[model samples]
Target: MESTAKQDPTAFKRIEFLVVTKNAELLSVSKDLVEHYKFRAEYSDSVDTVDADTRLSSSPMMILISLEEIEGLQERMKNLQQLRAAFPRSHIVAMVAGDESTDDCEMLRGSGARYLVLLQEIKNSSKLYYLAALLVQGTYIPVPVSDLFPSTQVNFNAYHKLVLNQKFLPVIFSGFTFSDKKYRQLETAQQVYVRREELGEYRKYIETYHDQVGAALKKRCRVMMMSLMALYSEILLLLSLDCEAGKKDLVQSKVSEFVQGSQDLGRYLKDCPDVWNVIAKALDFQFCRYERGPYILAYAVYISLKADWGQMQDVVMTALLADLGILDLTPESFKTLQKKNEKHLKPEELERYRHHPMNSLNRVMLRELEVSNETKSSIVCTHERNDLKGFPNQSPADKIPAEAQLIHFCELLDRRVRASLEDGILTHDFVRKQVWEEEKDSLKRFNAAFLDKIEKVLVA
Candidate 1:
C-alpha cells in the first residue's frame, strides 16, 4: 500500500488526529504514524485522563482511544459518551493490543469505537494512519487482516466493490479511495483494455460504458499510451538480454508484436478522420525518432499548417509510402543510394527518382482510399523545387503547389533529423541551423509568413 501522504496532497489539511494510549510502545507507534503520514497528532496517556473539555472544544477530526485506557478508567467512557453527544461530527477509533481477547474485541465494538485496530497486527504505523484517514473521510475500511492474523490475504475485489461503492458522503467527497493492491489491479486491467491492438474490441468496450464513452475514451487513451510506453520498455529489455540459442525467436516475437500493435493503432486512427487530425498534431511534438516513417508524416502535417498550405493529406500519405519503391533494394544498395550525390546523377537515374512521388501517389490512389484530388496533386509535385532547381519538369516557385512545398520542407527535416540521430548529433538546434544555411536562398521563394510560423513552432 502506498503511503497516502504524497499521493493525497490534501489528506492532512482538514484531519486532526488524537492518539490516546498509555503503553510506551503503542504511544511510540502512534508518533511514527503521525510522522509518516505528515499529519498533526496529539497524544494523551489515557482517554479518561484527557481534558475532554479542552479536547472537544477544538472539534478535532477524529479521536483514537486505546481500549486498555478505556478499561482502566471505565468512568471515562461516560465522559467519551458525553463528548460524542456534544460533538456529533467527531469520530472515535479504539486502539487495542494484539493480546486482547474476542470478548474484549466485541466489547470495544459495543463501546462505540467506530473502528478498531490491534497494536500487534500493525506491522508499521503507516497502516494505522491510513486506516485513521479513511475513517476521518467516512470511508468504510474493512478491519485489517493483520488485526486478526498476520499476513492474511486481503480480498481487494470485495473491498473495492463494497467499500468504494458505498453511498457515504465522505467517501464521495474525498474524490479518491484508499490506494491498495486491488486498486492497482483495476487500473492495470483498464490500461490493458484501453491499449489493446484490436480497435473493434476497444470500441466495443467503450460502447459497453454507453453514456460515458467520451470520458472513458479519454481515460483509456492515457492508460493505453502508458501501456504502449511500458511495452516499448519491455522490448528494449528483450533486445538487451544476452543472446542464447532460443533468444532470437523470443526477440523476433517481440518485434512482431510491436509492429503489429503499431499498425493496429494506425488503422484505428484511420477509422476516425477527426481523431486522426488530433493524433497527427500530437505526434508532431513527440521526441522519439526511432520510427522515422510516422515522424515524417507528423512533420508533414506540422509544416503544412505552418505554411497555411492546404491539400496536404495525400502528400503526407505519399511520403509515408515513398520508400516502397526502394524496399526491394538490398541494404547496401539502399545506403549507397542515400549517399549518392544529386549533382552527379545521370539524367535517366535522376528521372527515376523524380517520378517516385507520382509513383507512390498512384499506388495509394489505386488502393481506393478516400483521398481528395488536391491531396493527390500535392503528392505528384512534392519533388518540385522553389528556384526551378528540382526534378521532372524543373518547376519554379509559382508552378509548385503550396502543399508540395510544405512536404518538401518536412522531408528534408526528416532526413536531417534521422541522419543526426544515427550519427550521434546532439541538438535539434544545430541540425536546423545546418538546414537553413544550405537551403536559405531556396526557402526565400516560399511564403514568408509560412516560414516564420514554422520557425516559431520549431524554436518553441
Candidate 2:
C-alpha cells in the first residue's frame, strides 16, 4: 500500500546546478542562461555541494567548478576525484578562465573532469548548457577537450579589434551537430573529392582579388564564396569516389552552413552595389578559370536584376552549384556544354556531356545539405526545358521546382551573353539587345513570371 498527500512532483524533481565560484556576482546566471536552462541553481565556493542528497541524487546535477577562483589547485583537484567518487552520476564541469594554459586543460581532464569550459566565454554562449546536457548523457567527444576550448584571448580589432575574428574557426567547427566519426569522414571526404591543383588555383585567384577588393564586406563575401566552392567541390568529389553513402547528417550540415552563409551575406548585399559588384566580379572571374563561366554569371543575374531576397539566395546557390560535376570534366573541346544535346558532338560524347546532370544529382542528393527540396530538384533539373525535351528524367511542366525555372532562365541568359562575347561582338548595344531578345524569347521555355521580373532588371 502507498500513501500520498496531494503530491507535488516537480517540487522534488527540479534540475539542480551547482556552481563553485569565489564571486557570487559572476556565478549568477545571465539572462540567456536563465531563459535557456530553467535549472534551480545553487552557488558555493566549495565542491561539497555535489553530495548525493535525496533530491540531487534523484534528479540530474551539473557541478560547474571554477579553477581560477579556487585556491590550492592540487588539493582542489584531489577533492574533485573524491567528489566524483561520491556522486558517480554527476557531470564535473571544470570552468577555467580564458588565459589558462593548454597543459592546465589537460590536467583538468586527467583529474576526472568530464567537461572543461572557460567561464569568461560562457556569459551568453549557446553551447554551454548543450555541452552540459551531453556530458550528463555520457557523450563521446572525439577531439581533445582542449581542441574544443582553445586557450588565451585577443582583441585585434581596428577600433577595439573585432570580437568574432578571434574564435571564428573554433566556434564554427565546434558548434555543429556531427559526431567525431562523422566529422572525420567529412574532412576525409573533402581530401579525396577536390582536385588539388584546380581547387588551389581557384583559391589563389579568389584570395588575390579578395585582397584587392579591400572592403570588409567584400572580404567576408569572398569567404562565403570560397566556402561554397570547397563544399560543392567536395560533395561532387565524394560522389565521384562512391564514398558519400550513409553520411547524410554530415553532408546536410555543410549545405546548411552554406545556405546560412549565403542568407547572412544577403543582409550586407541589400543596398551595397559596390560591395555586390566586387563579390560578383570575383566569382565571375574564378568560374571562368574552370570553364564554368556561366556559373557565376547566372548568380550575377540575381544581383543585376530586381528579385526577392529569398528567391535571390535560392537562385544564387542553384546557379553556383548546378554544374558542380563539370569541375571533374576538363572541357577542352567543351563548347556549349550547357545544352542537353549538342549537335556538334558524337552521340556517346553528347551522352557523356548529358551525364553531368546525373553527376550533379548524385553529388548533391546523397551529401544532403539542409536546402529546400526545390533547390535539390533545381540542381538535378539543370538541363530541363519547358518544351518537355529534357533528358534522363524529363520533368514535364509544373513538375520542376520554382527555383529550377528561375535557374533555367538565368542559365539561358548567361549562355547567350557568353556566345555574344566569344563571337567578338564588342558593342555594348549588341549584347544588351542579345540579352533582351533572349529574355523575351525565353518566356515559353523558362517560366514567364521570372522572365517578366528579370526583363525589367536587364540593362544593355
Candidate 3:
C-alpha cells in the first residue's frame, strides 16, 4: 500500500473517505479497499482522534464506522452520534452485526446515520467494494428486515371495495395535504380511474405516508417486495441453466412459492383497500429497481386489476415469462438495443428484436409446465398492438388477449413513471397525463376500453 505521508499533500488535500474501526478484520479489509479504490482516506480507532486531526477540518465525503461486539451498545451509539454532530455534512455508514435486533438497527439509523449494513453482508471483500461504490454514488440500500412483517395472510372478506367518488374520496384520505397546504380531494377518483390532475397528487400523498412510516417499516416492506422479485429472477436463472431436466422440480417448487406469495401480497394489500394506492406506488418503486423490472411491474399492475386468485396466478406467470426470450440475447446486445433507437438498428438486429415474443412463447411451450392457454397467448402477444402494427404477428385488438394488453400497458407505464421519478420530478401523474392527453394517438395501439378499466383500477 502507498504511504499516505509520502503522498503529495497539496494534490490530495481533501480526503475522500474516513474509516473508523477497532475490529482487526474490519481494519484489514478497510486498508485493502482504500488501496484498491485509491481513495484518499484516514483511519482511526476512535471518533475523537479523527476529530482532533487538523488536516480533517474539512469533512470527508463518507465515514464508515464499525460497531464492535461489545456489551456497551448504547455507549457505541453515543460515540456515533458525536461523530455525526461533528461532521454534519458527511455521510455516516454504520456497520452492525448480522444478528442485531431491528430496534437496535433503527437506533443506528436514528442517530443521524445515512445508511446501515450488516457486517456479515460485507464479509466478502467484493461485496464490500460494491457497497462502498454504490454509497459513494448516493444509492440508498434499504436494510433487510422482512422478519418484522407478518407472514402470508389472506382475508378477501376484509377487502374494502372503495368507491372513489368526490364525496367518498375525501373521507378515505381524511387528512392529506400537499406541501403548499392544499388538501387532496381526488375528485375524479372512481372505482376505475382517476383524472390526470388527481393522479399526481394522489400518488404524492400516499408516498408521503409511506415515508412517514419510518425507516424500519419502510425497509421491512422493501425486503418483502424484493424477496418476491428474487423468486422471479431465480426462475429465469433456472430456465437458462444447462441441466433443465434436473432443475424442473426446483423450478416447479419456486413457481408454486411465487404464486402463493403473490396471492398473499395481493390479499395483504386488498385487506387495507383504502391504502391500496400507497402500496401500488411503493411496489412500483421496488419493482422498478429490480433487474426483471417489467416482470414485477406487470405483477403490481395485474394485482391492482382485482383479479381472482386463479386469474392472478396466470397473469403473474405470464408476466414472469413474458420476456424470457430477451435473456438469450447477450448483455452487450441488449444494452445496445436499449440505448439505440429502432431506426438505428441494423436489419438483422431489428429482425431479432421483432422475434423475441415468439422466441419466448416457444421456450415456454417446450417447458411443458401447467401454464394455461390464456397464459401462453399472453406471453406471446405481450408486444402486439391493437391496430395490428405490433410485432411477432401484428395481432389485432380482437385477437390479443386481455392479459397481454394488461402486461404491455404496465411495461409502457412503468417506463414513463420511473423516468419521471428518476428525473427528480415529484408528479407521478405527469405520466398519466402523457397517456390520456399528450399521447392519445399512441393509445390507439392498445385496447381503449380495457385501458380505461385498467386506469380506473389504478386510481381505485
Top TM-score: which candidate number?
Answer: 3
All candidates in order of TM-score, best leading: 3, 2, 1
Computed on alpha carbons, the lDDT of every model, listed in order, comes to 0.46, 0.48, 0.55
Total residue pair clashes for candidate 3: 2
Number of clashing pairs per prediction, in order: 0, 3, 2
Q: What is the C-alpha RMSD of each candidate to the true structure, in Å?
A: 23.9, 22.8, 15.4
Show where candidate 3 strays beyond 4 Å: 1-141, 144-221, 271-290, 294-304, 307-310, 337-344, 436-442
Candidate 3 lDDT over residue span 121-204, tens digit each: 445313345335433422222221121112222111111113221111122222331221121222222222222113323333
Candidate 1 — which pairs collide? Answer: none
Lowest lDDT block of 10, candidate 2: 152-161
lDDT of 1 by residue, 26-131 (tens): 7766666566445555666654555443343444456777665554435545645654664455567666555555565455545565555555434321334434
lDDT of 1 at 304: 51
Please, what are the lDDT tens digits per residue for candidate 2 over residues 1-460? Answer: 1111113454443334555666553455422343343445545556654334422333335666767676665865776686577555456777666554556556766777766655443543323543443332212111112111122121110011112221111222212343565445335323111122233333333344333323644654544454455454444433333222445676666556555655545554444445423443433332333334233533544443446422655665676567765533323214234232266667766676577666666666555545666667777776776667775577886776666666665565555545555576554345545665764676446656555655544552
